[model samples]
Target: MTSPMEMDKLLHVAQSCAPPEAIQLIVQVTEDPHTHTFAKLAEAPTIQKLALTPEGAPYVQLLRLYTTGTWADYLSMAHQLPSLSAAQVAKLRQLTILSLAYQERSLSYATMCEHIGLAKDLRESVRILEELIIEALYQNLFTGRLDGVAERLDVHSVTPRDVPRTADTHNGHDAVFGLLQALRAWRDRSSDAITALDTYKRQVEQKYDARAQTMQEDHAALTDALRNVAQSDTGMVARMRLQETYPDAMDVEANRRTHSKRRSKRTRA
Candidate 1:
């Protein structure tokens, strides 16, 4: 596998060279599936510098085409890339399939043939299309199955292509803007969810605290009531015991008080 580091080294070489040499190297990188980082390569200062030159504009445009354009895009460029190698052309067609699968899950054979420039008879085109699908599957470009009966490619998943920063007739700006809006919407939803969870957590904690406080108050009141009841019961039992010990004590005490009062009155007289 061609690594990002290798691609970076190649880019550095391309940048230090003259415009013609840089264009050649960039094209080589674009054609190689493992080193296909045209999105980054296209934005390099060397490539941009090349674009400023009249002779380098075509090559710069070709790099941009590889970055985000499809096979149909190449055909529509008025045969400007007549010198592109057969292998490079085929690679571009394969990348076109990836782009199609990214856009839609199900692809009919006819659609693939038209898009990939398979201008053979129906049977031959279908065969070529199947071969391309198998190649892509082997490369792990996408997860999909070829439905021979349906004559369609049912894509389960696909890797997304890099979106171009520059505006072309394909409306790259709209795509970038739409992606930004989606990210912002996801952020807002996540924030709202977090806020709701925090509120719910606080509410549950508050309820538990209040319930504990109420239980403590009830326990204290019950303890106080029990103590008072016990004290009252003890006092009543002591009084009953005293009565049992001296049943006629109250009558004797009353008589003694009357006698003492009578003697005191006689002395005073």
Candidate 2:
């Protein structure tokens, strides 16, 4: 926070500095998020005037994003704009997005590209992705494997970036809009989890059903086998005490056939 008096003093000094000098003051002040001076200069057309110069053009663009740009629009400018301090801010905005897209320490390259609206050019996409990864690594944003072969950025750990609540735009409406976005994201994730759980449950049920059908068939076969054993009595009655004594050693089912054959032979003789 800064005093009204101090803000006026800074603004007056910015006004006195001519051309590129004024641009430097504006960039330096706005870069530090602590000062509320940006809102006042933002209200005036002075920063917009800075856009006339090449160097000032970058600063003006940065100020516009600070005061006027939507979150999505702000994030998408990283690759479109030339390398400047504003581009750094754009990268930070990108980091905020990636932080949300990550899952269990890994993010697929395709998903990242989709989330960021990566350029269609394969070469450009690779260049931007490498820059993003390097910046994240250098800034200690997270740590993990950026596997080219695997085609995914696998993070082992992460620290989330803070959402900006700048003097230019921090109000109830902003908060509510942010909340709505968060809820929508949560809803999407919940739906995916439910779908996956349902799939797994169906698979388990199918396996159980197949196994149950097999058991029923086995039971039916065993019951039929038992019925055949109980109903058959071709040679169950013992002819004599010798037949009973030798029952365990006799093949009664086989002997019945041969006995008829022997009787027929005796009759012929």
Candidate 3:
């Protein structure tokens, strides 16, 4: 039987390897009862060592797999770890929901690495927001019944009223509400626009141009909200000034561009 420490060392080595092999090794190590691989590693000395490594490249790849593997397995692992804060729990739940909806069965190893590489707190926040959007989508789209509409229309004939508004009714409204709530919770939530743009670019490259366009539009709307606070004053002059001053604020768009460049450089380095 392999000692726990030996299993840890081998797991580390496996994580350092590339591709399907790394994943395969992880599966094997996790299955080995002698390894104590099931134990929480959050406070382990090894975890600190791994985290201290530059950008946690190898460790993050492994952590991602641990967090997002088979749902039941991951959940069991999560329970073994240090108890999460309310915010952390919320975020993880959200991430799970979004992962199921949008990236289920198709999440790439690279994408998983990116998510796990994020600062722990930030990772939690992203997970929460993603899950929030997913729940909103589910609540708005799936749980509702169309029977009322059909009964009202009194015919099997296809019509606007008869057709349920899946995208527009649920996802659209929920997206707006959820985005606003998320922004309020984290004012410095980084650029939703930039995140959306990156996601869109990736999706487009993957031949999901239509989905990219929708994401782009959603990002644009959220970006506008980020810049403009709702005000009670509605005088024509106030409205004009709001419109006029908005352009100046928009003109400061240079700052966002510069920030983006800096972030890209930091990531590359």
Name the 10 consecutive residues with the lowest summed lDDT in model 2.
Answer: 234-243
Ranking by lDDT: 1, 2, 3
Measured against the true structure, the TM-scores of the candidates, in listed sequence, are: 0.61, 0.37, 0.20
Sliding window of 10 residues with minimal summed lDDT for model 1: 245-254
What lDDT tens digits, residue by residue, belong to model 2 across residues 90-134? Answer: 454445434543434677666666655675348777667767776
Top candidate (lDDT): 1
| Counted clashes in each candidate structure | 0, 0, 2
State residue 135's C-alpha deviation in candidate 3, in Å.
8.9
What is the TM-score ranking, best to worst?
Answer: 1, 2, 3
Q: Report, for every candidate in turn, its global Cα lDDT versus the true structure.
A: 0.76, 0.59, 0.43
Tens digits of per-residue lDDT, candidate 1, 104-139, equal 789988888889998645787777778778977887
CA deviation > 4 Å runs, candidate 3: 1-48, 51-71, 103-131, 134-269
Cα RMSD for candidates in order: 17.9, 15.0, 28.7
